[model samples]
Target: MAVSLFYRTGSNAKEWSGTFEELERKQAKLRRASQRILERHQTQDGLSEDDVQHDLKQQQKLDKSAEKITEYLATHQEKTGIKGKPVKSNITDPDSAKMITSKGTVQGYNGIAINDDKHQIILQAQTWGSVGEQQTLVPVITQLKQQLDKLTKQKQPNEHTIKFTADSGFNSEANLEFMAQSGFDSYIDDNQFRKRNPLFKESETYETEQEKRRLKRSKGRPRLFTSDDFHYDEATQTCRCPAGNQMWRSGVNVNSYSQKYTRFCGYLKDCKVCPLQHQFMRKPSIKTGRQVQFKNDESRQKLSYGDKMKVKIDSPIGRRQYGKRLGAIEPVFGNITVNKGINKFTLRGQEKVNTQWKMYCLVHNIEKLRNSLH
Candidate 1:
């Protein structure tokens, strides 16, 4: 499956950005305003005064309920957790999600398209409002299966013939296990896949000229120690800072982008008096000490579905099959987005936006047909 994000017509500036504290304050202010209106009417003496008093009492009761909600919100602080961010819903299109594209973060939808490798024709396409693609594999593949059955006029479509290959974005343990159990040939790359490739072996060395100029610019400056400077022993499961002080293991396994890493932290006491602390630490008055993370290497004997897929994708045959993906789907998207100029959706709401994306895919297929007749 080939997926991409397209920015729509909304901006973060248009979004009502605030923390839980701010929201609590706003709710409290609203509750106070309601109370004032109720109190102002309570003093009035006229016909239906009983009804007015009853209505005012009900309003006050509603305000008290709102106050309870605000109180809960006020006490709990909003935090940006690891691999988390402030979720903003746009006033214009509430269904659109906040996406980080190559250009930058923008309000958009993730449009996914599965293409026929032979002709690079879109087999199935859909748009989702979620930022992550990991959860989309099953639904998209199920749709593709239905489409394949319809087009091929086969009751039982040869699932073996049609292999599903996707990028790392769709790769999850569940997804890999699904593909494996369903007996579908697949290839999905891992984060460290490129490290195995010889093409990037001299990648750092190729930028030697740039590095020399950078070093020359900061000739007298001492190079600050980074996470790489920290020594970690896998056998002992121990970490030591650059100053030769043993650090405490803060977290056993921290997950990021489907990869696990062990987190280590230095004690403030140890970091405070270290002679090389200034060289490694960000600041002298820092609350905490240096932190380092080392990638976890799970045992091959106990390989998970994701780990097995990683090994498969790094294979020569897997690389060859996966290599066809860019040509199969990318140019089709590039021609539609760049050549045909159908980049962003001009509609609002999920149904409308999804319809527009499918229409674009249909247009691309039509163009392909037109070229084929010649």
Candidate 2:
């Protein structure tokens, strides 16, 4: 049996943008304004009592709004153990976090579901408040084990070997290791798994040179020669430009993204005298020279999980097994969210949201059971 999972997002109840300290400062300013309004009622002979009372009432209303903000901060601060910039928790549904969907950025809960391959019956469902779905794999598998253990005590269900498949989002080294240690035949895709397949060899089409020139014209900037326009020789540690000029190694740089590169530049005299300088190279003479940066391979090979998964997932048998992942789990989410109209979660807290998620999955499984009986 193929066991698979995917994420279904929930809607947000409210939104908050700033930090807790900023909220507290606004509350303090409101209190001071309220005090100043009452003091003006006692003094300032030109002012009438009615005007002073009206100002006080307006300030009081603002103070009440600040009070509500303070209460929300207190509740969320206790709930989320970690706090950092662009504070994550929503004001109304404190348990939900900000997630990016196809529509836009949404403050919501991530609903995870595991389903059986035979009839697409949901076996387990969980809701999480994390932005990324990578860490949710372990918890989903643990719940699946417990649910299957309970079923053994109830009755004799179909006995079949369990197989797991998921998308690239769940393709970390630790996750792959845990799946192996748990003794399951798992087929998880890495980020570039499909690129490794021989079937996609001719799928990549490059932009025409005329199209590239048109883009340069629209941008209102002179076309600069990029690194891809140069040819590198592995046998001889050197690089040559499109004009057949050998570029000398200028400098080495360690970038912020943990990648190393060697910068190459042509001779100043050669760049200044070349006819193609304005066409391919930087036109300005003060600009050092035609520069190109080549990335080193050391930092790239340090992580092997991507390469390892690519080899496994590119196999013929692996493709056949993983093809069941989307059909197995995605229909369960579509049935609950689209067909059954349980798209937006009505609960506020984490525990309540999780219960609602499970209830929807249960309803889906019951419908599957009813169809099988007929």
Candidate 3:
């Protein structure tokens, strides 16, 4: 599993802590490794000039790495895993080429805060070198699950399943499917799905008329059905079209907001033969209008539930719940960057970086526990 390392601000402001003694130890190790590699490449007659030059270049690279480690430690005075005194620096100054990572770039370090759904306390906190929240969801949730498992062993028996609540950032079809299969309950948004409501007038009168004329020009094609084509006789629970045609009913599905809707679709032949065929055959000319047709079963289910979820989330109670997210997760980063003063990573390679990240997370959790006791 990928580990999360939390921080405030961006990558340049992220904090990691080590002593001057530890830096010296790492420098010595690098020197020894370089010496060994050079010795193995030497000839029996001593050393060739070419071999010597290669060794020099290798040594220079190692030396540069060591220098960066030293400079990082000196500029920040905090002990490992502890918050430090803040120092002012030229925030506008750009990082030199030497400071760039292997990816040949520096980007924002997004702070992620995963909280316990029950208590609203932050469970896991970490920062990512990448921007956007989609990639961070699984790793953060996994870490939070681990913490919850440990906490559950010491708490009540009834609390077993883990529930997560996140904004639209963590809401993707794949993520939702993963959470459902993992035995986790999530209130993730269906960001891609747009609800179709006839009451909302989005197109202007002139634009609507222009669209109607365009549809009239394209005849003998697949006709599209507007909301006007279907009439919902709620008293009889049946749908009829303006051309005196009955619609085929596919049972009702209940939505998240307690609104249930019955789905109805018309036959292709009935639509093609009708006077409305011209309007239905032509694709909608309105660039931003919602389609009135039910594309699929999943889409039909989403029509009612998706809108309710959006409405509920925008309510006062939902706003209060969402407000807790920033507070719960952001401090883990502030402690690491502003408090601990760890800016750039000392290690290279993905595995090494991951190990370093896990260590940072451990330190953050310990700090949280320590502060809670006080």
Task: Give the winner by lDDT.
Answer: 1
Candidate 3 local lDDT, 298-354, one digit each (tens): 333332323434433333333444455555545655666578776455544334444
Q: What is the alpha-carbon lDDT of model 3 when measured against the actual structure?
A: 0.48
**Per-candidate RMSD vs. true structure?**
17.9, 17.5, 17.5
Count clashing residue pairs per candidate: 0, 0, 14
Rank order (by TM-score, best first): 2, 1, 3
- Model 3: lDDT of residue 329: 49
lDDT of 2 by residue, 43-120 (tens): 876877787678878878877877877788766663333233455556666667777777677777778777778898
Residue-wise lDDT of candidate 1 within 1-374, one digit each (tens)? 44433334333333333445555565677687787767767676563868787777777776875675565555544544226775444434556766677777777788888887777778778887667777777898777777777877877755544556787777777877556645356677766666665357554532468755765776723345655555466677886554446678999879977888889988888787765565666578368888878778743123366655654555445567778877777788788889998787777678988998899989999989898899
Residue 159 deviation, candidate 2, in Å? Answer: 10
TM-score of each: 0.56, 0.61, 0.39
- TM-score of the candidate numbered 2? 0.61
- Every candidate's lDDT: 0.67, 0.66, 0.48
Output the better candidate (1/3) by TM-score. Answer: 1
- Measured with C-alpha atoms, the lDDT of residue 314 in candidate 2 is 56
Best by TM-score: 2
Candidate 1 wrongly placed segments (more than 4 Å): 1-14, 17-87, 202-301
